[model samples]
Target: MRLRDLAELVRAPAALSVPGDTVAGAAAGGGPGRSTPGLAAASVCLYWGGMAANDWADREVDARERPRRPIPSGRVRPSHALLTAAGLTAAGVGLAALAGGRRALAVAVPLAGAVWAYDVRAKNTAAGPATMAACRGLDVLLGASGGRMRQAVPAALTVAAHTYTVTVLSRREVEGATPALPLTTLAGTVAVAAAAARKGPGALLAAWYAAGYGLAQARAAADPSPERLRAAVGAGITDLPTLQAALAARAGFPAYATAVALAAPLGRRLARKVSPT
Candidate 1:
């Protein structure tokens, strides 16, 4: 496949928004330190794997609804996408094992399974959002694999809740939505922000994260149209790193928090060229 096609298929720019998943998890589990890089890389690999598998599973529907998607548009073959997913999943698990031994694999293995399951079997069902949220929570738990899983619980739940809200909003990306949904989600975001703010000096970052995420959703709350909802979904995806950073900050890793938070603007800028959703 061509370079641009590969990038599009994997949603490369969006990967920037995912690494913080592990970072936050690790921090919450008891400071990421050296394990951060490997865990983050593993998370990104699984995330890309999920994206590829999603396209492969939804190729037919995408051909009708998203004709320009790599698989639907014929820019990339179905086999290639499936292979990509497999390779990435294996690599992700391997990396997790390398970083944290079997402890990490315990979480990584289930996470990989959840990703594939969501893309192939759950995306259109009532279980879709919950499944996706579970995958995200597992991603966080993967980082805490070799550490205290209990410590990461709060951060994991927060991220999962955000993922749930976003997944719910995504269901109506092409159909538009009622203000009630966005408003409800906005309230949830407030709760997430409040939870994140209780940790440490990281409360400041959480406050900013809340503002950015809330403002984006507020627009959707006001308009509730397909276009607006789509924008809101994109914003929610891009803003994830900021929340991750707040989680990290709460865990007493201000530097890591800053690093993750810094990726948000870049993710947003790149989204202009490549849709994160």
Candidate 2:
């Protein structure tokens, strides 16, 4: 998978660079002495689960337009998906502890487990969008200090941002004619506003970069040209995580925010490569 695609999976909006805004210069890297590898793994597991659910939703289209994928390419076994997803979830927790603090691992693994189960099961029902947003929000919670408003802000943003992305996919599901565009826009607005309102420079940096990141993601998603998508993915690579750390968060926020920013476009690139353009 392309680096952009992996970035997207991480869904770290701040990772991307916007043409005009300054990221607050917050500290870089995870705080010292906090490495809950289990939380990190949970994050990956949760993301893959979301991807799997999305794959299920687009099976037919993928079969037709993109047959080289694991499912369509005859490489994936439907019977094994369940077991694989489960194993990944367990491994995710283990990894999260390795990357995040113990507290992050403790809170994240269980929450991720719950989210993954829902994605595989109940998430397809009417509750799909809600569950999806909640799962993302849960990740922020796991990453945060205490679900305090400062920490909760990212969780709330995840709900809106991811909801918007999913709505874009839903429109694809319906074969055109957008679904919940208004709701998605509104949610995104609230998320942006909320993130902007946070007092510290860190939140502001997150918000500044987030604004551009959201726009770019939406632009990439709405674009119809497969060629254009491919090109844009290439363009997206210009702002990889290292540059993001060195530049975007230059003034106010930490460099890790740059890593977060790298997640979205990179994730998109990876998704396109694996799922098909």
Candidate 3:
């Protein structure tokens, strides 16, 4: 499934921190408006790096344990996996091009590489969560680069809070994992939702996304089949983009459109069930 590879390339893990409004800002045009292009690029670069990281390590674990995955399921190959990851780096660069000339490539590009390193190996090591915390810090710094730096402040803070909360959550709530994944991840979902709501209208959307993540994680953790549990948890991981989109829209921009686009039909189908009536 080339589509699956593409999906995997999206980097669900770091999605929340990508700053949807910033992305919206970049896609609409270049240079200062209400957002920072550098930060958005940083966020994208972080996510892309994370995907490559997953492909390198996490994907392998999934393949060995999760034969249903595209790599193990015969839907994709490692070559494709690697390429999918490489594509993210290119995409980031392309986004950077959209960024008006302000932030230095020297700064953005190396940070991107460091982000990749943290994602692929740093995350799994003891230094991993802390490493990501640093990357998140850097992401906000990137966002603040070369523009109305002040405008990026709120989004950057939001991103930092998210990264810190997650790092804390993973370190505490998710240690020595078991079927408790649902409860732990559900809590995480709720926490992130609350974090998103730090603004306003985003609260409702954040809650909605959190609920989705919770339901999915719950369903996965409670699956009748243990084998399915892993798959379910793996599937639940896909919520990263939805969570990010909710934040972008909250941050005040037209990010919802692109966020929805990134989610695909399946997410929309789920939305009918998840959306408040």
- Candidates in order have lDDT scores of 0.89, 0.44, 0.51
How does each model score on TM-score?
0.97, 0.58, 0.59
What local lDDT does model 3 show for residue 102?
41
* Number of the top-ranking candidate, with TM-score as the measure: 1
* Candidate 1 residue lDDT tens string, 1-277: 9998888888888899888888888888887767668988998999999999999998998999889999989899999999999999999999988888888988999999999999999989999999999999999888787678899998999999999989999999888888999999999999988988854658888888888888888999999998888888888888888899999988888998999999999999998998888
lDDT accuracy of residue 225 in candidate 2: 43
The TM-score that candidate 2 achieves is 0.58
> Pick by lDDT: which candidate is best?
1
Model 1 misplaced regions, further than 4 Å: none
> How are the candidates ranked when ordered by TM-score, highest leading?
1, 3, 2
Measured with C-alpha atoms, the lDDT of residue 157 in candidate 2 is 49
Prediction 3 TM-score vs. true: 0.59
Sorted by lDDT (best first), the order is: 1, 3, 2
Query: How displaced is residue 76 in candidate 1, in Å?
Result: 0.7
